[model samples]
Target: MDTLLSSIEMLARWDVMAALFIGSIGGVLVGAMPGVGAAVAIAIVLPVTFALEPIVGLTALLGIYGSSMFGGAIPAILVNTPGTPVNALTTYDGYPMTQRGEARRALSLAYSASFYGAVFSIVALMLLAPFLAKVAPMFGAREIFLAALLGIVLVIVTHRGQVLPAAILACLGIFLQTIGIESTAYTQRFTFGQPWLQSGVDLIVVVLGLFAISQALVLLMGRDKANDLPPVAKIGFFSQMKDLWLYRRVATVASSFGVICGMIPGVGEFMSQFMSYAYAQRSSKTPELFGKGNPEGIVASEAANNSVPAAAMIPLLALGIPGEELTAMMLAVFYVHNVIPGPQLFTQHMDFIYALYLCLFLLNVIVVAFLFFATRTLMKVMLIPNRFLGIMILTFSLIGVYTLRNSMTDVAIASAFGFFGFILKRLDLPTSPIILGIVLGKLMEDRLRTAMARVREPLDFIDRPIAFILFLMIVLAIAGQVWTVVKSRPNRKGTSHD
Candidate 1:
């Protein structure tokens, strides 16, 4: 109780409140505007936050991460376009509701369901805090290495359709992390004797290029499409709140699904959305109503979507492992602030964790209330042309990257990655694995190097309890993926012959 009170007192400052407010508004606008995702927004804003207090910076990012999905549902419903990538499933039913003149209803349900999911996930995580404190200390070097290895394997196998491509990109990201001289050996691995290459690649630089710049180019150069928003009925936002009770079970189940996927090392929102949306349909008596404006679908997708951001924090804070890209970016924040997450944090700085939880809780209230009154105003953001938004994003990159390193070389590196990102997007390749591979790759390398000295053989890598369990899971996941691929090959081959 004393700890909780102190956390609240710590947040009772002007800067913290301001960060929350500004981040909330920024998140809504980003979500209302198509193609401006939270990752790019975080990447652009990350440099600026380095100057602020650590708690304040994290609060701001949390605001954006927690609230954007609510805003994303707006474009999904009104324009049949997802403002954020996770919102793609929302359009399946949300847009249909709009076409039937129930836009306000769809928006309300999304907002409410999102609120429920975020709250539920945060509460669940809080309950797990004691458990995590007990468990985090058990991670030895071998266990940590095995966990990172499992993460790499999960990254490779989890992409249902692009397993090969994701594996290749994951390897590439792991390789990129090896550019500088190794830490213990002081050996140059990939520098090739170039003085400038000694620093290797910056994660922020890559993020700026791939998410910020490449996305800008895609918006700048790609043909713009017309978005005709359907007519909305005369309905107050509060009117739909009553309808949400009808789908409470669906929302609860979806939120559970979100927590499960978010806790997983490599799986994120899409997987949760897929699982929850499917479960909702399968359980519903009117399963056929799903793809045609069913309120249940919106609830399932948004509830699961919002739940993930908080739940994804579990592994990150507990074990020092980032499960996905957003957390990876935030991990950089922790490192930048000289605040390491994991066992030490779990045991010593429990108050920091509590403060973050409060921020997330308050963020939901602020964003939901803001969306209630400001959604129509926020949707106007989408009216700005992609070319203009793209230009602004580039301008942001120039300012942000310059602020980061004060070097034009970083900008050039970002440009290279931006082009690479555009090419990956054009090829429909996944980008998350690349980032994950980089983050976990370093962990695997350091831990593996340490474990190597203590080990007798390769089998000894999984000698410990946690290490053995993780290794088994990795093997099972890989086997399952292979079996799936082999099972589906004959069908594709038969289709080609036909």
Candidate 2:
């Protein structure tokens, strides 16, 4: 009751409302552009938040977090490019819908799903977070270690078809995590005395290089000429609303999947969308229609991706652990304001947190309202030339990386990752596993060290119930991969025989 009242009070403030509107609009615009994500948009805006109240600052950040999902679908539908990595799944069906002259329907589905997912997840976060926060402190080093293991296991299972490559990338990411100084021992693991390397690689730099710069390079490699986009068809707002109503169950299921996946640390929008798409494919009556202008695919992907921003906030708000790169950046913002996240945060700053929830809800409303009025204008941006789009992406990529710490070394690091990303792309290697590994590596290392120090026998550490469960998951993942490989070998052999 008190929390709701406090949220209402915060919403009544003029500055808060203004911040929400501006932030939502900015987030939508930034998210709409290919290769730019909420993280880059928020990082660019973080410094400006230094002047605002805590609630206001968070309102702006949350607005960006929520609306960017919708923004990502813009390029996905129009240009066969995803504005964000999370939106990559959307491209499979969204672009196809556009190619069939259903751009407006695709856009409409994306906006509706994004709005519902964001709103639903925010409601879930508001209701579940406080209870989750109460339980978080009970998690010891062993449980955390198990949790980290489970996260990595899910990554492997989710990318099962390419387990070896994913494992290799994950190990490489873990290796990157060990590059900085060891916190407990005060010893550098892989710094090699270079001052810049001491900080290791920024996750943001790696993500931008892999998703943005590498994508640009791939785009440039494909052709010097650009493909023409289909003309935008007029779509009635009421008609779109009816279409969304028809697929409410699909959106709800996808949003639920997203919320669950988002709650798990390290797995974010990418896995959520993929999982949801798999589920949708299995459940849909017209499974063949998927990847061929299926509206359900757009609903599943968009809902899941949008839901992640809110769901990812769960661990951040409750346990002080960010689930992905964007939330990690948001965590820094909370630190800047001296509002440390975790159990103490809810009790100490309940008003602000509630206000943030309200802002998230309102931001969704704002985005939907804007999309309702300006869908045509926004869709036109999709028709912009590929070369011009590439230039803009490159410019933002440079700016976003430079803004990380205002360091030239960071830019060089980004370029280096760009080259590596290009190589991985050519080899058809998944970059997501590398990201998962990099983010989870340090956490895993820290927990392993702590558990080893406490256990009399090293093997005893794995005997814990949670650890055992994680071990089983790892076994299952490996077994699954082996089975897939064995099955493929026979197919190749039969082809040779034929």
Candidate 3:
């Protein structure tokens, strides 16, 4: 009760309110732009925060971090473009909903679920962060390898019918990740003697190409088709609220997974969203509804991704260890403010910690408020001509990719991948698994190699209970996929005969 009172008192300050408001708007704008994510937004604002009081500055930064997460969903749903890479899962069902004239419903569900999920995670961070942090270090190299392997397996399973093609793309992604210098040896592996390839491909460049640029190319090729806005029902905000309330189970489960994943070092929002969506699909009553405008899919993806930004702060605050890239940036902000995070943080800065929690909760409320009031204006974006919209997306993609490293080689890599992504799209192969491969492959390789170096035997990983459980989960996932395929064969044959 004292903590709650202190947080409420801290939040009542005018400067804090103004800071959060401005930061929220900036975050939404930055997040709505492709390739510019929370990391970029926060990094840009980090220097500015040094001039303000600690509560005010940290609250502003937190606002940007939390709001930008849901901001990414805006472009994702309307344009099949993810504003942030983590939002790639949103496109699977969100874009389909827009095509079916349910953009408002999709957006509502995404924002609402995102808010609720963040609430869950923030509460968990307040209550369980310390305990979770103590256990986090127990996740060794072998355990990390198993977790990443599970991520790869779950991503492959997301492609229901195109398993083989998805596997191939995943392998290609892994292969691409190996193009730069080897992490351990520092020697070049696949650079082909080119200086540009020495540093390897950037994930942001690949993500922009795979999602934003390739989507633009598809639009350009289909330029003759008019961008038509379908008629939408006059659904009230309360109606949308009711819909989201019905999916509370999904939001809860996904948020829980997000918190757990956030406690593990090196695991990003991608794995959390991927695993959540997979779990939702398997547990859903209408499993076929996924990837086809299912509200549950949006709920799972948005809730899981949004849940991550706050939950990620857990390891940072409790253990002085960054959970992912974005949190690493936040750690810098902490240092700038002369605030040291660790077990002593609660004792040394209890007020700031509780205020941080409250600030995060309010950030969600503010973003949702902006969305509600601006929905009609924002929805007009869907009516823009495809040619102009496509050109804008391509421009953003190129600029976003180029600005990352200021190298033409990066631009070329993105362009090449854009064309390749279009080709893969035409072939009906899933590109997401490729992304999963690139993102998780390097981590899995480093961890597996480290684990192997530590042990003399091949079966040593199973000696650790957590590693053993993760391996068992991987085997179960494979077995489940096989069973699903076998179960579908008879039904497929019956339909063919009929």
Better model by TM-score: candidate 2 vs candidate 3: 2
lDDT of 1 by residue, 42-90 (tens): 9899898888888999999988888888888889889899999999999
Which clashing pairs does model 3 show? none
- Compared with the true structure, what per-residue lDDT tens digits does model 3 show for residues 109-181? 9888898889999888878645654565667778767777776776676567877787788788789889888
TM-score of each: 0.96, 0.79, 0.63
* Model 3: CA > 4 A from native: 1-114, 124-126, 224-360, 487-498
Q: Which runs of model 2 end up more than 4 angstroms from their true locations?
A: 6-23, 35-61, 78-106, 199-239, 265-297, 320-324, 328-355, 396-406, 448-453, 459-498
For residue 302, what is the lDDT in candidate 1?
95
How do these models rank on TM-score, best leading? 1, 2, 3
- Please write out the lDDT profile of model 2 over residues 1-498, one tens digit for every residue: 887797799789898888889889888887776655675566556556756877787788888888887887888888888877788889889998888878988999998888888888888888885686567665567666666666666666566467778778878988987887767877877888888777777766777777677766665565443435566665556678788888898999989988998887766787888888999999999999999989999999998888887787776776566665567656656766787666567666677777777788888888988887786677655555556656666677777778768888888888788778878889987876677677667667776787777889866877766567667776776687678778777454446533
Where model 1 places Cα greater than 4 Å from the true spot, the runs are: 231-239, 491-498
RMSD in Å for candidate 3, one decimal?
7.8
Residue 130, candidate 2: Cα error in Å is: 4.4
Better of 1 and 3 by lDDT: 1
Ranking by lDDT: 1, 2, 3
> Local error of candidate 2 at 424, Å?
3.0
Determine which window of 10 residues in candidate 1 has minimal summed lDDT: 489-498
For candidate 2, the per-residue lDDT at 74 reads: 81
What's the true lDDT of residue 85 in model 2? Answer: 70
